[model samples]
Target: MKIDTLQHTSHRTNLAQNIARVILGGFLVMAGTSHLSWSRAEFLAQVPSWLPIDADLVVILSGVVEIILGLSLLFFTSRRRQVGWVVAAFFVLIFPGNISQYMNGIDAFGLDTDRARAIRLVFQPVLVLLALWSTGAWQAWRKQQSGD
Candidate 1:
């Protein structure tokens, strides 16, 4: 009975994780689409002013990259661990943009106030955690660290 319970719990966990992964992928794709389309200006507001590249070009390229990452997350089950790591890194990499938005008081995505922007920044880490946990990347990393 205990073994059966364990198996059931494991299955439920996997199902939840897969659902979360799909949701995150869909969200990324939608955001990416927005970056290239109606919300281009809004995305530009998030780009750090100190970045040397043209903001529009950066937004466009990041949009393309986001689409690719989202597709990989949704379809590349065999490489999910790697994808998760990359996704987490991508989140980390883009964090400076969020900080820039807050520090510069650039309003975008309904985050008009400094407090709102600061709150938005808090979610980036959650995204990183989501990317890692939903794909079991965190567990894999732990196992590797312990040399299991």
Candidate 2:
């Protein structure tokens, strides 16, 4: 059995993917923390009445989940695909929150308009892509991870 230099190159590529995961994970943690720091009333106002939980609790819990998922990515590099799955789940779960924010005219870090809020919605998939990229799924699947 002969292992060519290509194997070493692929190994390095995987290592780069792992590093990207850590960077993205740290970024997500910081973003989630910012949400946590938001005024509870402001966030509460954004939550729709249809959701079961209190608005304040929902806002806080969402931040906690984001932070946890982000941190998990850093520590669970070997399970990149599994982490991606979890992250995708989080994205789906929080999507309603994003919609609520948009509909309620909530200013998320001063993003006030529905258009601004709606534009922000596009990034959710990009975050998922970052997660999937960490798993090298895009490489295997031949899909554009980011719209750009």
Alpha-carbon shift of residue 31 in model 2 (angstroms): 3.0
| Residue clash pairs of candidate 1 | none
**What C-alpha lDDT values do all the predictions have?**
0.86, 0.70
Q: What is the lDDT of residue 18 in candidate 1?
A: 91
Best prediction by TM-score: 1
Off by over 4 Å in 2: 1-16, 38-42, 137-148
Superposition error at 7 for model 1 (Å): 23
What is the per-residue lDDT of model 2 for residues 53-105, given as tens digits with 9 covering 90 to 100? 77778878877887888888877655556576678777777777778788877
- Among residues 3 or more apart in sequence or in different chains, the pairs in candidate 2 whose N, CA or C atoms overlap within 3 Å are none
Question: What TM-score, to 2 decimals, does candidate 2 have?
Answer: 0.71
